[model samples]
Target: MSDRRAIPPHSPPSPCVNICVMHKTRDLCVGCFRSLDEIASWGSMAPAAQREIIDQLPARRQSLKRR
Candidate 1:
């Protein structure tokens, strides 16, 4: 059997792609574009709060790509 389990419908999905490297200049994760504090507190954040962070990811990714 697979070790993976389904996430509950109400929970916000994590953005982690397992690449945990931190960008030296940007202070964000190069893989998921989340800051260190965001990553650290993600589990405890409310669904709405999580969604707020997720909403910002696309813009962050775009900014990184422009560099």
Candidate 2:
């Protein structure tokens, strides 16, 4: 007998805008504002964690503007 359980859907889509460039001073992607580690591990993160990251994006963008 095969054990079947419904797997939760993936977290919300990545914020990648396809610009794909890491800011030199900030070490964050200019398009998505995610750090290298965040980008790499996004696929495995839980929905809540991903949402947290998403929520922080606007602030990150604003900070970048100040740089």
Candidate 3:
């Protein structure tokens, strides 16, 4: 087996469900909740970067909930 355990698997498809809208102020998506730049570059970014962004989502949602 390879020694690449630190990397995550390929990104999963967007669960868009046709609800494509971005958060105007934060440049995040109200639907998928990813930042616009993140969404745009999703296909090319490496798994580590993707995981870093994915890791922020829950906190973002919590911030939104507080507002």
lDDT of all predictions: 0.91, 0.95, 0.73
Model 1: ten consecutive residues of lowest lDDT: 4-13
Please tell me which model should have the higher TM-score, number 2 or number 3.
2
Model 3's alpha-carbon lDDT is: 0.73
Say which prediction, candidate 1 or candidate 3, comes out ahead on TM-score: 1
1-67 per-residue lDDT for model 2 (tens digits)? 9999999866898999999999999999999999999999998899989999999999999999998
TM-score of 1: 0.82
Top-TM-score structure, candidate number: 2
lDDT of 1: 0.91
- Write out the backbone clash pairs for model 3: none
lDDT digits (tens) for residues 1-67 of candidate 1: 8899886547588999999998888999989999999999999898888999999999999988888
Count of steric clashes across candidates, in order: 0, 0, 0
Residues 1-67 of candidate 3 have per-residue lDDT tens digits of 8776665577756534466787667777777678777888988988778778778878887776676
Candidate 3's C-alpha runs over 4 A off are: 1-9, 12-17
Instruction: Sort the candidates on TM-score, descending order.
Output: 2, 1, 3
RMSD list, candidates in order: 7.8, 3.3, 4.0
Model 2: per-residue Cα lDDT at residue 20: 94
Error of 2 at 59 (Å): 0.4
